[model samples]
Target chain A: MNRHLLAALGLGLIAGPALAADGIGAGLLKSQCIGCHAIAKPENTSLDRLWERKGPDLYYAGSKFNKPWLEKWLQNPVRIRPAGELYARHVKGGTKEDVVDESGMAPHPKLPKADAEAVAEALMALVAPAELVSKGAFKGEKVSMAMGGMFFGKLRGCGACHMAKPGFGGASGAELYTAGERLQGDYIYSYIKNPQQFDPRIWMPTLNLAEPDLQRLTGYILQLGATEAK
Target chain B: MMTNSRQLASTFSLAGLALASCFMLPANAAAADEQYAKAARNYDTYCAQCHGINRNGRGINSRDMSVQPRDHTDAKGMGDIPENEILKVIKEGGLAVNKSVLMPAWGNVMSDTEIREMAAYLRHVCNCGSGK
Candidate 1:
């Protein structure tokens, strides 16, 4: 009878924190995140509606972000994109140059460690479509920076939008230096395959990249982001 | 003896012309080469991404873009485009001429003088004189 009592006590102790953590996460999502973030997958992908978004869509956070990075980032959030979410809206100055208006972009709210972890837990549950992310899009193919830059910079002109490094590339899109650590390899491949499927009104064109080139570009971007994360 | 003197004068004149050409030819050729080199450098930096390094509209970005970048090497196509039209495209971007907005305007980045130089450079690349 004593042994049975002790076993029940042990099981309760082990499961208590786990269950409480999930409950806490759910509560936080309701109170803190829903205001600016879209916890549920948004059906509207129109540019006009997209312009109204304050923060990045988190419906695919599970597929898109690394849990560790997301948790860490939530604790001390910083600017990710140089141009911010919508470059067109945030830009100022003369029409000829169109410089980024730093004043227009608001910083993300910081969270405490416990809250960050709980929030990350809630976010990580939001996975993108299975067919796109589950498929073996990226097979961990090795790509050299030199070769990747040939396709990305010299050939594709990605430098005109996304920055490869600080002050090196264009600011129309998000910086790619931290992509490796922040994003999953599969998500990168899937996003590149067809950005329109996820974001219909995005300025980014679908390259319809084939094998080897697709894998190579994914590997290159991952390598680039990894280098910066370190 | 008189015929020999006249022949000598003709030979000396021909020799002088050849010597003068030797000095002048390289100088002219060097200047022309320098202009072409500068034009190529500019084109590579700004236009090569969509227009291609070969100037053939087969740039790396060409795969995904719906509208094809204008091919600079096609004499027929380039010949139809006037010098002013080329200048407008460079200074105001493709949208200025009812073309693709994908082509960013270089007016802020490049000066009016630079835009004119680019037009001349395009002409050189096409090997076609100004359409007008």
Candidate 2:
């Protein structure tokens, strides 16, 4: 059994979208999205990497994107990336434009309204919420924050990449010591789980942490800006 | 007549041994060839991305990446990572072992057989083994 299969495996495998929706939405995603995005399978070749020119992977969209944002984006595509895809101009050498135009993103021509709703629901269902909550979804507590702070620097080594304050941590990844005050929890959670899923070809390590560890880490980091102390 | 029967039995046994060897030889060759091909392909698609086309950490994506992708061609660093550790990292993912979350787990993506093949390919490309 995988490490996720702990004895307290509440809700178990049925924890995902299968129990929430009739699956009509997931069925549509399978037809529409699977060509580019992978919910589970990994491979040397990915259609998203090839066809999109450059973009984020969507294997864990269920866990990464917020429900409302996902629904909105699906219905109306937006330009989230300022630089487009990083490797958009890799083949053409250093010359030529590199970014994908923001105006280029358009709504699916044939996605029915019903299917969109279903797809959104299905995708949202992909994340295991309870597991996230258990880890460290702290409503607010000084002790939790303090403990989280210590864990973040020494144990997890989050300081290695991120640019936290002088005593906070290092600068290997995004600055997240104060992520608690600035970014939303879901956004932080998704980014922490798989940075590249939101932004393709990102360099953050695909950390193999337990669900609880991830939630705790996310929770602790999210509270960084809210601590009210320097 | 007794001598003739004994000779016939011996010949049959020899023939059976020959047929078995014939089957085993081709099967062994084909299996080895298939693994080699898979290893080559896995290296081209997966390892080459971070390690560059030449098994060095100079791929296009490696430039802007926060942590400079490890130079697999660096004999010194490659020596530190054992084949078993590399296999574990590849299969379980970089973050699982508190290494880097950037390296995703291929367990969901590739099969065990594919992972084994990829492991063999890494050894072939790096050529570091237990030492640099």
Candidate 3:
């Protein structure tokens, strides 16, 4: 009996660490997120596979999301992409029915406070390579609304797809009116610099803007959040 | 199994003949209508968000924009505009024509054939060169 008890204790010791590492959050992620989100590391960066995905890849969620913002978003979900991930699939013939239904996207399920916190914790653990988040990608520089607005609307033509204000701008991408509040500056800078890194088949073309222009554009997006607060 | 295989072969032949007819046929009213329909569908996919389904310039995104989207149905305004200019705008965006920059360059996204088709649809809508 003593030998059996000792063997059981040894097995418990062996399994405890593994269970602790992959706790409730990991289980929840498997159950709730894997259906839509790509929680596992992507095996290939093929555009065809990227297009096949139902939702945005969250493999690099730790690098992409601000924890607090993610937590809040999980609790009270809202539509980000006006045309959904694949705009072609969402926006059909320019009809009243298509516009009203927003057929591309289904509403994200809202999580309870505890579940949201747990999910946020799990997501924050999902990190990409260090090279993806290089130093100086985001310097937290400030940009005035006038200068940023000019670049967004005229110089760069970002306004074509993204809205700087409600009901304004382009209708295909994530609404930029709330970007500053919604996104992290680092994620925004990195994403705009090279969207292919996050999503290979995304409709957003690489602008190939100069470094200064890139900084200015990121600053403009960050400033939009503060501007809306007023 | 042999009978079923024969049936499948006959079905495939029928489908192949139908497809071949579509290509060999001369331009007809139905073909023109199909082309127009395709162009209209393309416009809805790419342009209708800002340009509106009816080409009236009051799209879902129009209210939020600083400059209003151009009303394509405005025959007088569109009449003066050249076909080349319309094609240029579709290819290069409003910035190409010194118009609003809110229009994005679609050259990267659309093929030349698609752009031409869009221009044709635009002309059809405005009744340009139809002599009223």
Candidate 4:
């Protein structure tokens, strides 16, 4: 009956639904993501464990993916790896029949906007190791397209597996053209330096590139997103 | 030293035998066709992105690559290359043949038989003669 009591009750009513939504989000991730993705800390870091995974490791999703890209991808799933994560399983023969089978690989399940946002928010909380996130890991350096392109295509052979431009390059790995917009710069640097740290069974071989080349390659990946924007 | 009539008769017999051997060509052709089909499928699944769906080396991914993929349709460029070279490239990648390293070695993933079939397919695309 008192004014103060009435105000307190109204605040509680507003906060209750928000709290409930967060709970529902956590529940949704547990039910949906656990089946395929590694939502929790991975128990094994062996190559065998990588082969056994059905989907990419998302334990570092918060530090790996750009928030907007993660949210958008969840709402409308698209093929990032042209050949899927495990290329052998996803890509069959090269015939028309084979192409059809390749198309039939398990597509990422889509989520409603609210569910996607909730899931994205939850995923973003999953951070990487402190060392991986150490200051100056990326240094925000820039590289000329020519230099970056050279490192990708000639020096490092990255184009063999990843698409440097839309529709160009290898089909078995993730298209790198949009990587700048899709991934965190630090994650890209870290992953390129050593993909085994994230996924040991990843088909991509380590180039063991020199430090300067690595920096150039990372800079070029960021440039790819900018080029796409134009 | 034989008479004209006798010589004509022997020539006719030889012609008949040659015509009979032509019948075996179809069976051999069919086997080649099957191998080619498999190779085509393999190319589509693995190489089509950079090599182009039509195998012209103008795949969608080629646009951004610093080194363009070899155009299989280029009869002149691929014609002189031996099947073994093509196979080497497929299995060991471009660097193995002193080419660009942009091509990844598929040895770890594809079997020897598949690599051979791919070589045959490349020859077929280039319209190159079987490197004897």
The candidate that achieves the highest TM-score relative to the unseen native structure: 3
Deviating ranges (above 4 Å) for candidate 4 = A1-23, A46-48, A95-100, A132-135, B1-100, B103-132
What is candidate 2's CAPRI-style docking category based on DockQ? incorrect
Candidate 2 or 3, higher TM-score? Answer: 3
After the best TM-score superposition of candidate 1, give how far the Cα of residue B77 lies from its true spot, in angstroms: 14
Regarding DockQ, does 2 or 3 come out ahead? 3
- Give fnat for candidates 1, 2 and onward, in order: 0.00, 0.05, 0.23, 0.20
User: Residue B62's C-alpha lDDT in candidate 4?
Assistant: 62
Least well predicted 10-residue stretch by lDDT in candidate 1 chain A:
A89-98
Counting clashing residue pairs in each candidate, in order, gives: 1, 24, 2, 9
Clashes of 3: 2
Model 2 CA lDDT for position B113: 85
Give a tens-digit lDDT track for model 2, residues A1-230: 65556733655555643555448877877777776566543564443354343334455556555566566556765433222333222222122212123354443334556766788788765653444322234333333776776666555655544544533222223445444433456656655676545434343545656666667777776566555324
Model 4 Cα RMSD, 1 decimal: 11.1
Error of 2 at B112 (Å): 8.7
Instruction: Please name the candidate that would achieve the greatest DockQ relative to the true structure.
Output: 3
Per-residue C-alpha lDDT of model 1 across residues A1-230, encoded as one tens digit per residue: 99999999999998886565467776898798888878777777654566688877787888989999989999999888776776555654433233567888888889999999988987887778887576577899788888998788756556656777776665656788888888889888888777766766555556556877778888999999877557
Candidate 3 per-residue lDDT, tens place, B1-132, comes to 999999999999999999888876755656766879867766765677677766887665565577788888888888888888888888887878988777766665567998888888887788776332
Question: Which order, best to worst by lDDT?
Answer: 3, 1, 4, 2
